[model samples]
Target: MILENNDFKLDVTSEIGRLRVLLIHSPDSGLGKVVPSKAQDWLFEDIVHLDTMRTGEYDYYVKLLMYFLDPDKIKGKLADIDNPESKRAFFKPDNETFHNSGKVVEIQTLLSDILQQKDIRKKLVAAVCAIEGCTYRLQLQLIDIEPVELAKIFISGSLNDEQMIFAPIPNMIFSRDIGIAINNHMLLNKPAKKARARETLLVKYIFFNHPLFEGYRDNILEIPDTVQHFLRPGEEQEGKTTLEGGDVMMVSPQHLLIGCSERTSVSGANEAIKLLFANNVVEKVTVVKIPHKRDYMHIDTVFTQVKRNVWVLLRSLTIAEPAQDESEPIAWFADKKNKDRPEIVQFRRGKKPKTFGTLEALLDNISQKDLQSTEPTRFIYSGNDEFPFDAREQWTDSCNLLALKEGVVLGYDRNDKTVGAFQKSGFEIIKVQDLLQKFETGELNPQEMTDTLILMPSAELSRARGGFHCMSMPLMRDKVH
Candidate 1:
């Protein structure tokens, strides 16, 4: 099969590198269908107001990304784009007025693009039908429908606004977990939960089939399940090799971090380490395993890098001492090994595994040693490291941030305590709406922006339990200088 290569480059060398291009999914109708009872099964803590997420919250994210990554699409068009009469046509992937910027790419568009091929469309329709257990008649109907509308149904599970053909993949908006970019390679995820199974299938097809990644097809890595994984007992299923992009962080060109959390298994990290070393994708890989809890789903939920010399983290899980209770001596002893404090271990090819006592120590090592920063790494605690606030803000993703460039990041506006922490760290904070206006007025330039935190509204977006980092899959970024 011949694939005509586009001008897009598949690369991401550092967390805080200047983001050149990324993949994101705007909130679709599927996000609106998450009912309370099925929320947990669907990987959402609570159902979100789809309209508000689209117009009030996620719209700004698309605009901000466009302004920074592809300014020509957004510049001098804010008022016309937001005009009520437009009915958000500018943001809809299926609409004619959609801002199909080459830099700020959309998953839905890519899905539709691949579906245009006859053989691929037939295969994907059959695959989805088999997974969803659809009737033969429904499968035929789907295959007959046009590619654009069929692609929408595949994501939203609805033929139209009123009828749902299958369960909606509501979690698709968090595109990061679909795959991750490591330096010049793309490592896809094998999702941990049944709810995200369809997402994985759809994304795998996109990355392998999309023309934009034509030249880099061989660089796409997949983590296969362990031999006889299906035979694993139910009680031991947690040990199965399940990896998600949320747990994978490309910190530097030579280093990577894999988190063992609720969404990623220990075996997954082990497999990833072996693969990266065999491929020479990186020189070192660190597996950071935190307590298996839903609140802290992945290591990104616990901490993220803001710059080469700065990081934001949840002190309770990353740095707090293990609380020992003498009443339960055995349990307390066990907790010390894996509970309160994170288990940090770094692995390199043909080298002894190195361990760190705390996340702070590991991040500092990355800043000072891996990236060679001149100054010591600085830390900002979630919720300002206060008792209830730390836990509260962490739940809302205070630590989950996406750096636009070194020292410039994007996070939820509602995390007031975390916002205060950033302010104390000598970073200027501005709301997204205000910042967009400033950009329109030429008051601030994104390229020159530094030590800044751009706050995004999260009333509806936060209910989905992810941040900008989870919502993004960076494809190309300038090497951190």
Candidate 2:
């Protein structure tokens, strides 16, 4: 996994062989904490029933991954392990404070009670991540702290409550958003906010220590320091760096598309690109600036690549407007007297401007652009279009599809408008329910459905702000033609 500058070529010409060996964390009791009161702040738009959501998600993983590789071939962190010795060895608390201060005992007891596990190590790990106790602890910690107070201190939320409560990570099941594996190395994402910090920790532990990934090298990246250095004076408020994997689309080994959105900033993207390029981890990183609206949280929410030279994207956001170059210059005084040490870095400032066009026009432009040049260009749409607003709305997620192989993909069954567009584009749609039935009956073989599109019912998934591709991360893909 040693990345030489020449080895990092990013080209998204096809979905083929672009990404292989994805890592995912299934939703556990951690999802139970998403309520109306806590949902929005945690980036969830709706509260979902844990049971139903899990059931739907299981179908998604089974059908989708099975289509590309053997169910046994794909790896999961939550999969069962038979060795108790191994579990204890991996999860045992290593922190001196946690072990010596009785916090380990407290955690073990709480986890055992909630997870019904007899093992102390397993219980403590799961308990710290469980929804019931985790939230109770966090809430109790924040009870009297003003938003202002909480803002000033990092990790300010409490851990002192006796009663354990956990927060729901409804988004965890969609493992692709948390981390990505490029070639032989794994990059665990550092999300923008604290609510998802646990995701980063979970990914770090799994990639570094998971038995399944023991032979692989880990290449994790964090932007806090770079953000601080690049934005200096604005680091505390405006230039806080945050980038999620969802906004990144690998066009090829040599090219990548990065979405500059609410969760990821222009400065953050610039900083990340500089690191990737300077380190030779990527040949070219194209920053596709997206909106900051809550509904459109990450770029993947609006755009996703489905096959070579073809893409399924939200017509509006993806092609709506050209991301304005809003970068602002920041001054840094490096050793005040050492005239050679003065440094200045520019940070993008202001919200992105709005687009004025129809969805089709935007897609048309993207298709026409010469994306290979070092200089960046964008495609946008004009407002007037024939489709209804609902059709356009569905296009946002309506067409956001995830591919297991070339033409084979997974999407929401309820997005008829978007589904219609796919069919029109020559995709074979297999209803998610049908696929699940076939799987249960042993009639469907994932490896056999190599180049087909499998659509999952979005009745539950759509409410949570993701689609088929959003829910699953592709670990490996056959080489593109």
Candidate 3:
């Protein structure tokens, strides 16, 4: 599936660049096993029907991505893959019927590729077995399993459909959290929750051992813990250095954004700044200290770029309604209270740190200064800036849109008000199925698609609380000059 090439590019300078390649993991068997009691612990808002997520919702996403990034794989096989009797073999990494696309890559395929080596296979098996607390006999049995099956077992935590050996990593579907690709480099994550510990371990092995990433091995950046980490917070302690990929964003070749949120701590942001500076990864790093709340787990959940001059974001970060009425004596001071406002500061090597008053201001500066957009920047607010709907749709990942090119993005169909905002912005809105049909019928082409928002089915996928942006890790893109 890797289809290794010496020319495989790894540069990603802007989030809205034309996507060439990416890493994604489809919903595995583990996603269906999430029970209600452990849903919150496992970082899910609700238990979803995994079958629907795979067939009805996510399969369309895979098809749409293939049509855009790797069309040869899905252009002619729509009917075959859409058949229920196919049992999603095209999405499964091990099956002969798998798409095995080099562009729309499956992380499991990379894991299996590295696992085929006897020594690497043994080490990975032992590591996974130890983490899952497998019996000595079972560990030995696991080591003897074939590479493809073993990789599936490692990810799904199941030996067979009937036998679950350990907890399934339902979160692996959100591959964006595993690592991120900056310009010619990969920044691996140190996740905050124990539930994601194994996910981090597995991805680290793939990124380190997979031959496709061999050349960039030296470019991989791992944030180091504080020297006094021994005295730092334990698993239950507060404010330890943990950084998830969701919190980190490479906005431009010389500009990166790191969020200090519920999953990413201030210490994590500090280490990232120092590391990127020492490594010359960027000229400026903006630290956005958002509220440490589950409501806004990462900055990406609240905002993502739709184009060089356009951003889709929650309005709460930019708009403030005074808690006290104008008639009240302390109403003016209420604005100064800074309720829910993100603390944004930019760091450059030799320059004094710069602070931004609002999220909108920082993004406008990025559009004008970093991306060189001459037009006035625009923002499409979640839920059309409506009060309760804004919060509700933000919770459903309305702001987490993934740009295929500059103006085309993928979003959930359920975010009605947000879709309305885009429609009002003179952007064309179409369901993903219809667009895919057009692509297949030659009525539309991905290259010609502009200012369009492709709506994805979200009945089951939305329950996972991540959008396509959170589900992708872009590996290559044409830089927006």
Candidate 4:
């Protein structure tokens, strides 16, 4: 598809807009691999059945996208490229297989070389997805081998290092966390966790090789080694520096809120802003420091903007001490006298100090009923009123909501206390199932509905430590004023 008109400007002014285009990936079998054994390692707090989750998520994308864009306007990576001929073409061999045993070494050498090249990187990544190849395989024979036997074989020089191969990436369905588009630029994230690295690879291929976005493929950005080393060192780890798009939410063209938690770090947020502003891509950002607990890893875990000056948040964290002011400081000499006289002089420093207090106090001081119109800032809440422990649980995403437009959003239908708070604040809430029915019955005009909230059930997806917004990425949004 050709973008004849550059109508979709990144300078967002509001969340409600005429839905134009969006990108989504349906949940697939990869979710099935998230078992109790590997859940924690993979950053999942709980494992869920793939079938139900996929069904629910599918309804989410289909119904949600149909509301904003032309039913045919929205696109999905898996849906667009499912043609049999296309799959055959992608997996067709470009080179002949080796006939001689020695040629195996040649093949290995070629594979290694190709893996490093930019063009071949694209091709190989495409092939991996096309072939659905697993990078690792279980060796039944090796499973029974005893430590003594393996050690003796190794000592006798009878063991080989090539026994293990590559493993398949089983988590591409959650495409939002793997790669993101900031304005017109694309940044393929290197997820700090090992289990999600394949997500980055798959996204790299789609951005580079997909015919729909071929023209802008070169806009991809990578994390610099210097920043990576500073945040996540190869040796002794002293500080945290991991960040993900799922945790970062843009409130406006100039303001961004980054969540600092177990999955993201203070340094990571700083470095990301430096890179973004240095590249002239973004002007300002607000770093919101969330607890390091596993449940509240990203900013989206607690808050999301639903409409202009409206937000649905976990009242606890948003109103707790507001995030420390992460703005850069200005340095100046207070006085230049007595340099040679050896007289005492005071040095004054100026800083954009942060407000640390209860959420009610902060809001009272700001005197702003709407959050969007306030000076670009973040708010934290005291613990939940219903249950003191709800803060930790909610921070794990008990309150996150997804905005279909400025006034519209989606959240867990059962969070009545939280939903009551939103309704009190002037939001109109609807269950996801109800909304789907509205669309089906033609009671709702998908394109005409600007700001609406469609709540999803948290009985299953929430245990995995994410809310509606965390599980989704908005490829396109209306400019928020």
For this target, which candidate reaches the highest TM-score against the unseen true structure? 3
Per-residue alpha-carbon lDDT of candidate 2 for residues 200-247, written as tens digits (9 for 90 to 100)? 554554445433344454344545445236646643455666677777
Global lDDT scores for all candidate models: 0.88, 0.48, 0.89, 0.47
- lDDT of each residue in 257-343, candidate 4, tens digit only: 455666666666666766776666555555555556554555566555555544445553433222233474522321111111111
TM-score of 2: 0.64
Q: For all candidates, what are the clash counts? A: 0, 39, 0, 35
- Name the runs in model 4 displaced over 4 angstroms: 1-19, 72-173, 215-218, 227-236, 239-241, 318-384, 392-396
How much is 467 displaced in model 2, in angstroms? Answer: 1.7
The per-residue C-alpha lDDT of model 4 at residue 219 equals: 59
Question: In candidate 3, which residue pairs clash?
Answer: none
Q: Which regions of candidate 3 are displaced past 4 Å?
A: 5-7, 320-338
Please give the ranking of all candidate structures by TM-score, highest first, separated by commas: 3, 1, 4, 2
What are the clashing pairs of model 1? none
Which lDDT value does model 1 have at 30? 89
* Lowest lDDT 10-residue stretch of candidate 2: 97-106
Among the numbered candidates, top lDDT falls to 3
lDDT of 4 at 228: 44
User: Which scores greater on lDDT, model 2 or model 3?
Assistant: 3
